[model samples]
Target: MDIKLWQAIIYIVLALIIGAAAGFFIARAWFKNYLKKNPPVNERMIREMMRQMGRTPSEKQVRQVMSSMNQVK
Candidate 1:
């Protein structure tokens, strides 16, 4: 069976839209899973980092660093 020009264009557009939607959801789910496995920074991580840097971090210093990070975001 032969398709008309407009019908072919409609089918192509529909395919593109469907593909884009599927790609978006797949990427989003993968990103969420990746973040779940490798989560963002937290207070404990900050403290450990400071310790590794050879600095004994005080509570106030950690909180200050956290606040600064929050402000940047």
Candidate 2:
């Protein structure tokens, strides 16, 4: 009877662990999709950032930075 009880506990623990693992992956995928759909940073932000650093951004410079940023992702 003791062995049976321990076996049941192990099964429940295993199920809980598996469920947590699945949730982590699912949440990660959802977050990735959300970020892709609504990017936090845009060209304007990059331009502003450059300006803050004492550099005036030309359109071409902004475009290059934007392309490189996207490529890094």
Best by TM-score: 1
lDDT of every predicted structure (CA atoms) = 0.96, 0.96
lDDT of 2 by residue, 29-69 (tens): 99999999997889999999999999999999999998998
Model 1 residue runs over 4 Å out of place are: 1-3
TM-score against truth, every candidate: 0.84, 0.57
Q: Tell me the deviation in Å of residue 1 in model 2.
A: 1.4
Which ten-residue region of model 2 has the weakest summed lDDT?
36-45
Quote the RMSD, in angstroms, for model 2: 4.6
- For residues 1-73, could you state the per-residue lDDT of candidate 1 as single tens digits? 3568889999999999999999999999999999999999999999999999999999999999999999999
> Could you tell me how far off, in angstroms, the CA of residue 47 lies in candidate 2 after the best superposition?
6.9
Best by lDDT: 1
The list of candidate 2 runs beyond 4 A from truth reads 45-73
Please give the distance, in angstroms, between residue 10's alpha carbon in candidate 1 and its true position after superposition.
Answer: 1.0
